[model samples]
Target: MTRISRRHFVVAASAAVACAAARPARAADTVRIGYIGDFNGASLAAVATDQGLWAAQGLQPDLKVFTNGPIQIQAFGSGSLDFGYVGPGALWLPASGRAKVIAINDLGQADRVIAQAGIRTMTELKGKKVGVPEGTSGDMLLRLALRKQGMSVNDVELIRMDPSTVVAAFASGQIDAAGIWYPLVSVIKERAPDMVELAKNADFFPEIAFPTAFVSRNDVADDRSLKVIAVLKKANAFRAANLDASIAVTSKFIGVAADKLATEAANSKFLTTAELEASAADGTAAGWLSTLNAMFKDFGRLPDPLDPKAYFRADLYQAG
Candidate 1:
């Protein structure tokens, strides 16, 4: 995914805060966001920003696009951002620090692993050289997949490469199998005629883990966060209600053609405002976090366990 910073923008910056709750945008409420460049399922921040929904929540947002989740998560820690989007990996790591999942974005069909023609299944991938970007969702997904097939990362030749380079490597036969996300996965198929899906994220992780959530820095002002949360809810609602426009925005956001995303958009799911808040209170998301943390530890990805209650907050926003 391409990450562009100069294109980062602010909306309705001059709007007054006097009636912020009643109206959108104000000079005083500006929330900087660290957004990862991804498909329609994971690009809600880009979609919402493009739709100017943040302004409707009485806040202006400075959107910094990132190529991956860890760098985006770093923005929140650096205090350069108030909120951001990330996969479960970044949220689970100890380094992320107090960032909590505010909303569950896409549910599935966002990440997968593809193999050369002869390799038809995850089991066939054993002894094969597999490629994944270290520390990214691809890496986590690959790890989960290997475990499911009663294999270990040690069972295959693990090649840590950037997603951008994975396709080329696969084409050159540097790796027999690789975990990747769309439209790169799409591109891999287009370029490598031999590329075939070996496994998808849903094959192992929970829908909760597949979620690309809006996570906020713990220190963000409550009033500002409430307003930003309102925007996130509204934007999520807008996505379901005005999908065509949302897709158009997402296409530009991710620099992909709308037609390709249209197919993927149909496969994705968003955790509604009701669903997110309910999960927060019901301990569903928290439970998933605990399970995910444990899996990360079991896989040797994380050295220690993380507290789900401390990391997940369903109270961040109310339903629209």
Candidate 2:
């Protein structure tokens, strides 16, 4: 109906080991992989579960589902999540904290400025009330789009809300335009058939790549994490052969239909394990992360940015 709203421990000691031997393994032994239930990256888990890849990898993932990045960011801060497939802003975590990026998920299309029927373009949005889900992908893109247009948030009445609430506000005539993501993006289209998407995420091109990616506190080097990534990569390899069935499973997960997801899947691209590893080794991934980190800081999303090099592990050299 409406939209809304992770940890691990290990100890090794001679005496502590004897204590552990006295009891069976507890819940802490299980893997907790956090994921946003949003369609943007839901396929990772859907394919993993549907194809039994995670099981094959010997991981029974908790599969924590969140509404958006802002919510997941808290989990990261608390060290509750081991991995996440999130929007481009994943750089924010690694650059500033203990996270590291693994691979790119997709280039977003629905992160855009949607306005009421009468509004046709960004220029028309001047002096109108527009909403953005703070610290999310849509918010980041909206800021960049405005900057590119030679306009600023000062030119409009900026309202901040979550993606789901943005749709509700839009439906209630509380805001004229909003920076939103799916299924809210799809929800808006369905509920307001005449609505106009004034600017798509792709419009602010060249300046930012807007890559949704897989990020982790424990990267591929960790044996447990590596198993999970291997499973995910297996799912990626099988995606083509199982396209229709994959979409059917993902559709139910994202609460959208197979046709809609099929369209989104067409617009997205994936990288194999070898391809992603090569990108990191060659500096392609690092360069993009560096640029996007600086971009978010410039946009006021990140007040104090950290070095991009710290975002990835030294072994992978992805932050080079």
Candidate 3:
């Protein structure tokens, strides 16, 4: 396995964000799509754009890549974006009525609590330095993992760091454990092959779901929003069938090497069109959103309880 340096990932992500910020003026008919770069679920927009799926549907897309969901939400506020693909951390924004969730892209399975070989269980991490990106899905996972062991964030010496920095700090022995997600998890394993996994998102599945979502502003036309979802459905099938090709497209779009992205790509499992609709119809999607809403409030990231149904527009999918 080849190691993807922290500096390389940071520089690439920064450059991509800069380019998106400096993008040229869009045409009147352009559909601005904002997404988090280097993320598997959000990268589907890149796949659709590079493969000309949006154009094939007679839609003109103005793609903007951000480093995270909060920043992308700012674009939505400014009316700069018509749609967005965001992680679970930003689910509150939609549930709170900032935007409407048009689709559930995928459930997250790559987040984990990785520890050194000597630390075999979550109990062993007591008082040990654990690196995590605060207010992220990784942070939520870390707290949940701790709670499962009858512990809390207070029991660990929490070291706040971005995902890329978490990789570097963990690889250098600066941190004893990490609450992080893949592609970066893969990077850390490449650098420190002896690292051990203490817990993962899948460990609490069915009870908890960390899903990425596609959202549209309340003012966007229903037809246009449905078209975006249609393009994503096509992109999902294309990605599932042509993994290498999809990786190549995303690699070029994000400035990451295809080989480095391969592991991350393999770790992801996107929901198909039928699966997405089923999750919505069966109340699985609502349950996931409700979980996020409650988690955010518990973490003090949200001020009040918001109904997940307020932002979830499952009717649009049924109409399409």
Candidate 4:
């Protein structure tokens, strides 16, 4: 049997205790977290699972991991979620209706684009099928890329697919271009070394300094709002402070290679409360919100502009 290091054993033992301690005290009191990215397959979930972030706040999380924001938002609207993460573009659904954004979550620059073999430029995608969840953040980035070249979603065949499915589709020759996040991004690039980066997140929505966050009203009313933030903040802090250890734990929890987590941790940008709020108040962020709303309207995803103010809850960050 392999002897685990003392640090690894300590962290692992602590994780077991934390998982047990984090259980919700009541059904109504449970803070349902709808994570809309590669949650199970990524480092964020590992941080939550191992570092006792949720346990520290007395939160009972109904954690729903997803591959795209639209599916996660659907869960949010149906009254099944308390808090979750979303891309900047998917903010329209909640902004127009009920769910609220509390912060700017992860800003992963390398999590943006991974070009497949045979595609050298955005112009090369004129007649190819590109995979992205329609009306989500990746979708927004895709639109921005197209517009730069005097094109639109109509210019290329858009395949509405979950981010998780993107890699498989590419492997099967179903998609010529894929927009995905870490681990998957790493996989695609490794598989197709000759592919070119058509665009990155910064290249498109430069104003979107980071990804968006959301929480249902029920969580707010239940007094579990601060608990959610506490969990995320603690996990984020742990990730920031102990990158290697966190990566090892995250690798086991997410079931991805440890090397991938190391790569992601090196490239991902996390936000402090001050940093998060500053971006929320940015005129540039507001403009991006407006543009996102317009795109949603044009795509028939939303009927009109969703007020950016309605969705953001800066007080939560301030309190934290």
Candidate 5:
């Protein structure tokens, strides 16, 4: 069968669902999971499916690849998905009572501020055109990075552009810099090798954690959620132990070249089962969510920051 690319799947999710329904009957223990088709924490869903890890857990995986978090959240609300991998941009969905954050999949280290070789520090970005995809974690990172340097968006000529446009404009010299994440960051570096990284998501660290989470519907069964987490844990171990093999399978699943996918995957920092458990135990995960909440509110994207505990279900993760 011909494979569908992630871009195609985004526009034809409904049709894909219809096609899934027409396939031979699946096992009764089917689990409907949703994730963004990117090289972030959510990409593990593709690995799980490719490795039959879900089946090993007795789940007939009904995996839906989404273009973004909001669309995945919509699927969860419509009862089409039982669990979803949400990025930092939409972490507020759960805080708003729309879902429950069951696990912190990974800390986002894939985002970076890339600028012309001459621009070495965040403070130097003053008055320069910086491309940013507003409302994304990259945007938040840019704001925080600037703030850390006692600067703000007002210090820069912020040029709003989608990820793809940022790549093109940055490469063509239309923008002085861009706040973007991988694999687009990878793309930009390849297209403009002269560009230098000014800062990264990791630079903000504990002060501003950009984490991607595995979230579920508030009504999902505990047992099923536990099973999902178990399989994901196994998938994480597999990816860490067998990076090349993981990239080979994920490349086919994501429809990106193996080398490119490997580059993109290397940019992220996936948490181990131990790391995840520790973060939850130490209140680190909750702290991360709270930081994200405050960033959104500061940006005027949220009315008010909700308590992290309102959505972060550390209890569920512990039970797993």
Candidate 6:
């Protein structure tokens, strides 16, 4: 056996210690997040993850992504996630079933149903198969768009599919149009320019909105929920400050380029913390809840219209 010199021993010991330090820690403050829809802005959440903002705030989230709301909400109910982002219908899931709503994330901007391929407008969709994730905000918004134009779901063929699957349906010509959000929708448009964009979030419905939320077991919010809220606030600030960089980072995660990601980001409305609060309190969210309840009531998604105040937790804003 060779005797190690003092310098060699010191270097070897340092290396061993460094390697041990590099091992993943069992984060005591982990906050697992289940996300879906507008994976564009969810990229902001990704920024928070990559930058360790969650860790800096003494929280860690195991982030999982899905293409629709109800499925992610299922993960939240089944203990796979501690928090989730969902649309209005997700409220019905917990309200109508067994999950719970902790806080409202954002609203007013979600994906839209675009009539592709020389399709001129919503009315042009008559006799055409319009695709949407069944029983989601996208679906609700699509229905509302039809109703607003004095048309009904009967006027068009309804193709119930996951948002992820819509791209393929559109490509295969199985569906005349799709109600999808970006960056998938944007990708479809790029591949098929003949696919006309008949409606977008801004044009289809007047201020119809969805939710990106933080949902968990009822007790998770009892202790460290405020910390989660603060981290989201920091995330919103970071997203506001670094829109371009955020888009580029998102492009990598979504497998798209920076410019294409920017296009989707442009279609979205990024809310400030104060805007989030006001909307949650007395603005679009309040109005949308009333609207959502009425629509759900008609669609049988809800037993009846729920109170707007009952749908959100104002306490989270206060806690933040």
Q: Which candidate number has the best TM-score? A: 1
**Preferred candidate (TM-score higher): 1 or 5:** 1
Cα RMSD, each candidate:
11.2, 11.9, 14.9, 10.9, 12.3, 6.6
lDDT string, candidate 1, 50-77, tens digits: 8777767767777777666666667767
TM-score of 3: 0.81
**Where is model 3 more than 4 Å wrong at Cα?**
1-28
lDDT of 3 at 253: 86
TM-score, one value per model? 0.83, 0.82, 0.81, 0.78, 0.80, 0.81
Which candidate number would show the highest lDDT if scored against the true structure?
A: 3
TM-score of model 5 vs. true structure: 0.80
Model 5 lDDT tens row, 1-320: 23567767765897888889899875658888887656674567877888778877778888777656666778887889898887787787787788989888787778888998788888889999999877677787788889889888999999987777898999999999888888777778888898998888778776777888888998998899888888877787777677788778777777777776777677777677778888888998888888888887876678776697877878778767
Among all windows of 10 consecutive residues in model 1, the one with the lowest summed lDDT is 5-14
lDDT of each: 0.71, 0.70, 0.81, 0.65, 0.80, 0.69
As a whole number from 0 to 100, the lDDT of residue 167 in candidate 5 is 89
- 1-320 per-residue lDDT for model 3 (tens digits): 23568778888999999999999856445798887666575568877877788877678888887755666677888988888877777787886778899888788877789998789999999999999987666788898899899898899999987777898999999999988888778789989999999998889886888898888888999888888878887887777677788888888888877776776665556777778888878888889898888877876678785687778988886555
Q: How many clashes (backbone N, Cα, C below 3 Å) per candidate?
A: 2, 2, 0, 0, 0, 5
Best-to-worst order by lDDT is: 3, 5, 1, 2, 6, 4
Which regions of candidate 4 are displaced past 4 Å?
1-28, 36-45, 111-115, 205-208, 217-222, 277-303
Q: How far is 96's C-alpha from truth in model 2 (Å)?
A: 1.7
Q: At residue 265, what lDDT does model 4 achieve?
A: 58
lDDT for 52 in candidate 2 is 77
